[model samples]
Structures are given as structure tokens and as C-alpha cells.
Target chain A: MPKESDDLSTLGELGESAVLGRIFPRLPAASAQLLGPGDDAAVVAAADGRFVVTTDLMVHGPDFRLAWSLPHDLGWKAAASNLSDVAAMGAVPTALVVAIAAPADSPISLLEGIADGFRDACGALAPGCGIVGGDLSVSDTLTIAVTAFGDLAGRPPVLRSGARPGDVVAVSGALGEAAAGLRVLFAEALDANGAPDAVLASLVRDRTTAQLTPSPPIADGPLAASAGATSMVDLSDGLAIDASRVARASGVRIDFDRGALGADPDLALGGGEDHSLLATFPPGARLPGGFRPIGTVVAPADDEGNVSVILLDGKPYTVSGWDPYTGWKDSGVAGGSAG
Target chain B: MPKESDDLSTLGELGESAVLGRIFPRLPAASAQLLGPGDDAAVVAAADGRFVVTTDLMVHGPDFRLAWSLPHDLGWKAAASNLSDVAAMGAVPTALVVAIAAPADSPISLLEGIADGFRDACGALAPGCGIVGGDLSVSDTLTIAVTAFGDLAGRPPVLRSGARPGDVVAVSGALGEAAAGLRVLFAEALDANGAPDAVLASLVRDRTTAQLTPSPPIADGPLAASAGATSMVDLSDGLAIDASRVARASGVRIDFDRGALGADPDLALGGGEDHSLLATFPPGARLPGGFRPIGTVVAPADDEGNVSVILLDGKPYTVSGWDPYTGWKDSGVAGGSAG
Candidate 1:
């Protein structure tokens, strides 16, 4: 929660080894780690005989703005994004490895904040997770790439292509919060160096900042899988885009009821980066406790038919949402997308 | 092998999705991938229930120079660096996840070459290894961060603290070649476009390029471990620096023979990025086939003694090698170091 300060020691002044010296001690001790950070690599005991792995690259400006978010939040968001993917696979996160590239003139406090974010996310969301190893190098822009490894605990992984006709589409947590928060954060960026109204500031604190640094529904993934969920995905992209991805993969149409998703149709249907679990389960299967049904899976429409892979209240719903390519063009920075 | 050309399409023109489309099909199908790329994450079978993980961050300017290297070589070097670390742990690399940050205006062919490098590396070094997943973003500079996962096959991981007094030190492959190569490449950087003499070009091609794109002895790690090697590390930092690390960790001193290291004492003892495996074996132990003895581990120095961790020709050697911090202050660029 610490804000940026003007006077701080740059990474150049301290050096890579010394910066590492600052980062090493703050990491949590992971029981699954047989050998933690240091040495050439780290060893993690993967008792389930399988490892779920994912990585994300976040760059400054387009993917994030240092002026808008704290380094700790960046770290937390990085962890949350990757960990949610692991959780989406019905796995328990066990270890994380970070490779950070930053300018030598970058502050060591920025890195410490990133470390704090990693510790915070792992501590609050996945206590079993540990930051096992990392590499740091000098870059012109700040970039952090995180690879998270998870254990499946003997259960088969839940994939995106398992949805079938008659399967129910459900979500384990809130859907549009991240998208709303991002819009709020960007709006505040316009008032840079000034104060926002109380209402806007409160919304940023309660909604936007939370998404900028997310806490995904990691536990619901395994719970849903164990409850006989067929296919699953975390909503990093808008619901429409990601859901269509699942629909295309499974070759099924997912019909959504407008009333079921409640108000804020755009957020629920087109928003992205919520990190909420969306799964398809066989009809009448004992649904997981936390998941709420939002739609139903149906067979792909006939070639001659005009039915879409996604529908809103039984009608083809074609709506636009945040796209990395198109979205970044207007931001005045390179419109590159982040994971 | 292609040089930068004006006709090449840039990444911004192609967009992220299109770039990914081109990169995906080039990857060889890996059998160990229970679930391959294109999902939330990749599922890699770790039958032994243990994973040896290592990550490295490579920046364009300091860690590498685009002016000197081809894009394919950069990709190859990134994979070789991380895979070598897995091999250093006495494990077989199974999967890799890369997070690449580049300027949007960067040519798509550069990325294609990088993908080819990753592919070529896995094909040549670790037959079954596959790039399971990755994330791409735009940055002011091009950066590639690779994280590789490996299988230990139920063996105790080789650590750096196991070497004891009286142990013989050995290396699995060539040493000092990389440092010499760097010198050659750096020499070439001075000329810009003027082609070097035949001799320098050949040296740059055979020696420098070889270092830029290394082929570490991956299988030799397990062989050494099985042959009772006590301590091991990849000679990424010159022989002296890495050897000193092992010496301090094992509470012993390493004595090197200038004669055994081949020509160029400076390159052999003080060069960095060789990536060859340097290990210690107990006295009278049957050394693995590929390894050759270079030194011996001796008792730690007494408090009144002035023995250094590394010795040359029976005398304490204190000549300096690359120290990232002190090394880069004058580079004008970030002047950062790599591990």
C-alpha cells in the first residue's frame, strides 16, 4: 500500500547481487520446495506426478503504468494472473519463478514493492505457493515475467474443450470487476497529479485498484473439477471472447440469459481480466457450492443455420470489448497486449 | 540467418494474435506434454513427482547485442541458458515457457527467428523438450525471459554444497570459449558494417557464435550424478568465480592447474558464459566418461591463513573476471550483469 517516493536508491547504485540480497529474505518458505532460491535452480516436490505451468509478460506503459499503480500491486497482479491460470486448470499452485527486466535507473524500492506483491498474493490467495527462484537483468523499460507451477493432486486436469450439449455454464466468482476497475483506473490517469472526487476515489479503491491487483477464485477450480465440471477457464479476457474460445474448442454454443447475469451487461459479457472461474458441467451434476450458473451449452448449430457460439437470452450477441491490439493504439503507448 | 531487411513486416502490423499464429505451428509436438500449448496453461507429466526449475532474464543490449547476433541465435541462447541450468541440476528438461517483451515496431521475422531458435535448441539439445506456453508484450527494448522445467527421475538433486576436502574437480565440456567469443564479438561491434578479415570472421563465426548459441552437455549431468559427483554448477561466470562459489559453499578450497585448462589462462580461468558443467568428485571415484579433471578441493584455510577459495598452479589467484556491477558502469548502456 506504500506510495511512490521521489528519493530512492536506484538499482544501478545497489547492483544486481545486492538487489537480490534485498529480495531473497522476504520470500515465504514453501514446504513443497526441496531446494529454494539460490544455487543454479530450485527443486519442488510435485507429488501428483504432474506440473501445471503458465507464464505472463507484463510491460510498462501499455500493460501497466507505474504512475497509476504501485509496484507491489504490479507484483500481485502478475502473480494473480498466472496463478489463476493454474487454478483454472484445477491445480494447486506450488511454486513461482520470476524473471524481471528493468532499467538500471529503476529504484530498488520498486523491486521491493514487487517482491511484497508476490508475497502478498501468495500469502492471501495461495498460502502453499512460494517464490522459488528468479533472474534479474537490466532493460530500458520495466518488465516482469512470472512462471507459476502447480500440482494437480491426482485429478485429471479440467480443459477448455470438454463442454458438451446440455452442460451448464457457471462461474465461481464475480466476473466484471476487473474490467470496471481498469476503466476507473484509466479515468483517474486523466487527472494525473491531482485529486479525484471522493466518489471516484472510493470506487478506485474498492473496485479498480482491486482488479489492478487481483485475488482470483483459485480454490473454486479444484472444487468445481471434483464436482464433475467438464471444461473450465479463467476469465482473463472478456466473457464473450473467452467463452467463445471455449465454445469453439468444444464445438458447442453457450446460450446466456441476460437476466441471470444481472445489471451491467457490458461488464458481464465483454469485460476482461476478472480471473473468475467459468466452468461447464453436466446437467443435474452436483454443482460446486460457490459456482452460480450463468448459461447452458448446446450443440453447434447446423451449417445452414445462423446460430452463434455465444447467445444472449437465446439471440446471437455480438458485442465489442477491450482488445489488446486495438485498445493500446489509443493509449499513446505501444498497443501491445499483456497475458 | 537472414539480416534485418526493410521489407520485413513489423509486429505491430501483424498484431499479437497473428504473431502467435505464426509461432505456434512451428513448435514440434512434444509427447511429454499431457496438454500442449493453447490452453490456460500446459500440463507436463512429471512422473517422478519432482521438478527442477530454473529461470533467466536476457536483455537485448547488455546480455546480447542485436547488432552482433541473429534473432535465431538469441532465441537459441535463451533456451540453452535455461536448459543448461536444468541439466546442471542433474535433470532432463521437459518443458519451457518463454515471456518475450519487444518493441511493437520490431520485425516479425525477428520473432520468427527467435521461435526457430527455441525450436532448434530443443531439437538439438533435449530431444523431447517442448515450448509449452508463452506470453508476448510490447516494451521499449526486446527482452526474453525463459523458465524451464525438468524431471529428476527419482534421484537426489545434485547440490553445490556437497564437495568436501580431497575431492577432485572436473568439467564436462569446454571452458573459456564463451569469454573468448565475447571478446571477438565485442571486437566486431567496433567495426559496425565493415566485414572483418577472414580470420576474425571465422573466429566470430566458430567461437563467438558458438558461445552466443551454446550446446551444453545436457545428459552428462545425470551421468556425473550417477558416477558419484558430489557438487556441481554451470560455469556461467568464469571458472574462477563459479569455482569460488562451490568452494565457499562446500567449505573447501579449489586448486586449479593452469596446464590442464588448455591455452589462454585468462580465458580459461576468468572467462564467463561457458555454461559447461563444473563438478567435484570424491577421491578414487570412477569419473564419468565425458568429464576431465581440472583441479582438487582442499581443506578450508585456517583463520591465520591467507588462502583464497581459488588457487592457480598451487598459488592463490586473485585476478578479476567479469563483475556485472563494476563491469557495466562504463558501458553507457545499463551496464548490468547476467548470471
Candidate 2:
């Protein structure tokens, strides 16, 4: 932490305007934005008479640890997570409104880096989606809450409840990568006192970056929708759990082939934070380029009296999904609580 | 705080689904919603092909104190603050996406009350606006981040930059009320340890509720826009400060009449957080029913070399606006830091 006397300016020292002045320039301008920041509110072009909206929060403790993830990685993951939601709705993300509350003593560079990350992530993952407005606040906890908007482009929104009995369940992007990366970070990137070691975390950059800065297959969502997809969901939770959601919502059962899953089937089944797109497409339809068939949607067997919504190779598979409340622990590995 | 075994279940004990199941039922259905919660994203109708969007944050420390504010008040204020932004854009608020991150120990009833507050606030303030989507996270600090979206309704967005030299600056909603209420809270609602006392706060309900659950003239925004108002801004800051923003944005000077401002002229000018709409209309144009003329937009005296954008009875007034970063202190009077 750089002192106020040094070159690095803390948020407390610079105030909101100065800090925003540094960050506003770094953010990418959204093409869909009619009126951008600096006003009471920003106006974004919905274009098709409707807009897809979703909000997500990343708190300091449960979401990510500053030790394991840098400001850039946090921003990237935050944007990636929200953009994936819009994509899952089969909409092109147009703009995002980000509200970040950080400790007053935090360096202004933290916000600047986060802004740059937002700019780059939008450039790479969801091209043309940019931040239109945001709010800043002072808090003991560093919290990033992002609300994302998207344009449907005249396509009907792909919903989780649209899957049918004959639908083929497919996935886009890496399933177990983020979870595997988190496990590696927990196992390798801890200091002597059990705190996360950023330096050591960076040493396993390949693994850690996946957990810190996931690139969800954003374009695949609209493609899946365009290719006569029935239901779509962002796989923020593991394959089994998210698939179960689609199954439950659609009144169907999802049967996954073990062979379709990668080498670490258990990790693919139970681990989460992958942010992939899980969609149910019509059988025999060309699976979008980025998507691969992983499972099949089957009619629920009412006579069998089995309550399971997920099956692995014709057997009942029960696995829990990510619930922030139940999933969080006071002090844990990987992204531990800052407090 | 309720124990785990009590009738009131903590968030950690009930898990995310159960908590969400409780909150989802309490929220009002938005008329503009095509797809509501329990999905990847919500779809809202932007009838005119564009949506006015904004986001605002209320962190526990700098924004409010749980000791002084009930969960319902917190929810209402959060929604009110964000809705005002959309209203200031001269658009009708249609939906809100609220993300709340609270401690794991927080009771499910806290979220339930917040939901009820959001329900009631949207019902009373912005009739058709309702919660569309939201996210929850575990955090030490209680944070409420709200993003509001509005429909243009085929009208041009009233912008801060649109105030011209001859525009009659007016305000809709009470000025200095919230700030005065905050002063009352700081003056009376404190215990021996300098912490807020809810019991004491309740005694001054009239004063404190203005600071807690402010009902900004949400309807007056679109009304002003329809009435041919040239410019508009939400008075989240003081009249002098927010007017200065309009002045700066429009490249004009704003001169306020001291007599027109209620009895407490200085308080009305310098105090903040009224959430009122400060708008400018064409000279001699009939002011909206709720709007009262307070000032006038004048040509900037470039030759005089004075850069101050705001004036009170022909004299320069440069009162500062709210800045969470610079304004916050570790421990203060009204809504002090919980840490």
C-alpha cells in the first residue's frame, strides 16, 4: 500500500471526481449507448423494443480474494459473469452499469486497472458491449455489483424452461477449467500464515488466470439461439447442477454421458464458476460451432418415483450447485475472505 | 440477530434458494417485464427502442447505518435513489435490478423486509416500476447496488446540457428536507458510545424518514419532460451543486432567487440528498403542477473571467456536492461506519 505522500493516490485522497476522471477515459465507449456517463442516467439503444437485463454481485470475501486476484482479473470476471447472463438469454450485450464500493484507502490505480480490464474484456469476449454508467461508494468491504443490458436483435429470448424431451443438451466453453484452477490455487498459492500469496498464485498463471479471469463463450449464446436452441443457461454452477436447473424448469430429466465429460468427470460434474453456456438444442440440429453435445433431455419418469432431475449414463446423479450463502466459509482456501 | 434455531432463519442456514423463494414472492411484477426473475436474465420492454439506465450504490458505512435504518428503509432508499436517476433522464422508470450483499448471519427476514420495501416503493413512487432481476452475495459490509431502467415513451430525454440562457430553472420536490433530517438524526439519535439508536431515531420520524425512505417526486420527472422542460437533474446533491452541474454542462450560469427558496435558503442551497428534480423550462412557459420556479439560466460572463457556475441572488455560490470518497470518515454522526 503506497502512502499518501508517495505518487500513488488513494481514493480517499483523490475524491470521486478525480478517481472517476482517471477511470472514465480507460473505459470503452459502447456503440449502443445513446447518452453515456456524466448525466443522471445513461441511455442505451435497446433497438428491438426490448432489452435483456441482469445483475450480479462480487463481494470481497465470497467472490474473490485480493491476494489471489488482481483488480484487472476481478473486473474481467465480473464483466464476464454478467455478459454471460445476457448471452444465455440469446441477446447481444449492449451496455453495463457497474457499481463498485471499495475501502477508501484503496489506491486509485485499482479502479483504473478495473476499468482497463472492463475495456479489454468487452473487446475480447463480448465485442461492442461497454460500460455506460456506474456508481462509486466507500465501504469496508470491496463489492462490485454489475447490471448488464442486451439487445435481442429480433430473436426470441432463449429460456431455461424451453427444453423438450427430445432436446440435445450441449455446452459452450470450458466446463471444469475454472474449478480446476481454483483447486490449484488453493493447493499451491498459500503463504506461511495461510493467506493467499499473489506471487505464488501468479507462478501457476495458466491455472490461476482461469479462475480469476474466465472468458465465457459469449458469442455462442446468440449462435445457439439462432440455431433453433430450445433452452439456454449460463453454467456458473457445475454441469450437473446447472443441467438439473434446465431439467427442473423444463419438466424434463437431463442424462449426461460420462464419456462426453472431460478426463476429470467429477470436477466437471461438481466444480463450478466455469460460466459456460449450457443450451438444449433440437435433436439432429447442427450444434453451434463453439458448442458440443454433452447430454440428452429425457421425459421425467413419473411412475419410477425417482425425484432426481439429473442422470449420469442412465443413473441418478445428485450434485449441489453454487449457493453463495451455503458455499461461503469464514476463512477458506483459494479466494478466502479479506476480513 | 436471530439464532440459527429460532423461527427466523439466517441466510446461511436457509441457503440461497429458500431465501430467494421468500423474496421473489414479495416483489411486485413489473408491467414492462417480458421475462422476470428465475432465469439467466430478465427481458424488459423498451417501447421506444431505447432505455434510460443508471446505477447507484449504498454501502453500509458511508451510505447508511443498520442501527438507524430498518431493512425496509434501506431497501426503499436504495430504490428511491436509483429511480430518481432514471426519472431525472425524463423517462418513466420501468424496472430495477437490485444486488444486495449482506453478512451470512443476517436473518432471512431482513431480505424479506427489503423485498417488501422494494415492492412498496415501486408501487407508491414509480407505479409500473418493479424488481426485474437481482443477485445476492455474502459480505461483511451490507451493500445495496440498484440499477434502474426507464422507457423514453417516444419523448426526447431531458438532458443537463439542454438548458439554454433563457431557461427558467425550477425544482420539483422539497429541498434541504433530507439533509435537515440527517442533521436531526446525527443530533438526537446517538447513544453514549456515539452509535446510532433506532429508538431515538424513531422519535423524530418526520425528520428521519426523509433521510431514510425519501419519496422523490418520481412522477414529476416525465411530467416535466412532457411539459417541454429543457433540462433536468436529480437533486441527489445540494441545489447549488446540482444546478452548477447543469450550468457547467449547458455552458450557462444559474442564478437562484433567495426569496423563492423556502425559509431555509442556505440549507436548501447547501444541503444534499433530497432526491428532487431540478429542471429548467423555457421562459414564461407554464411550470409543471409540482414544479416551482427557483432560478434562471443566464449567459456565462466570459469577459468577467469568473468560472463559478452557480449564483445566489447575483453572488457566486460554490458549495460542494456529495463525494463518498472524500466525504466519508471512519466514525461519524449520522449513519456512522459500522466497522
* Colliding residue pairs in candidate 2: none
- Candidate 2 positional error at B34, Å: 0.4
lDDT tens digits by residue: candidate 1, A1-339: 644445488888887678889888777667689998878899988898888999998888667777666788899999888889999998888889988888888887888889888888998888889899998877777889899988888999999999999999998777677766766765764454553344444445765755678778888888888898899998887777788889989989898877777687656887777788889999998778578889999888888365468887777877454434335544321111111
Q: Per-residue lDDT tens digits of candidate 2, residues A139-232?
A: 8888888999888899999999999998898999887888888888878998998888989988998766668899999999889989999999
Fraction of true contacts retained by every candidate, in order, equals 0.77, 0.97
lDDT of each: 0.79, 0.85
Once superposed on the true structure, which residue ranges of model 2 sit more than 4 Å away at CA? A1-7, A303-306, A330-339, B1-7, B304-306, B330-339
Clash pairs detected, candidate 1: A181-A208, A236-A273
What are the per-residue Cα lDDT tens digits for candidate 1 across B169-245?
Answer: 99987787777777675566445455334444444586576567888887888888788889999988778888888
> For every model shown, what is its TM-score relative to the native structure?
0.91, 0.95
Error of 2 at A86 (Å): 0.9
Looking at candidate 2 chain B, the ten consecutive residues that score lowest on lDDT are: B330-339
TM-score attained by model 2: 0.95
Best by TM-score: 2
Q: Which candidate is the best by DockQ?
A: 2
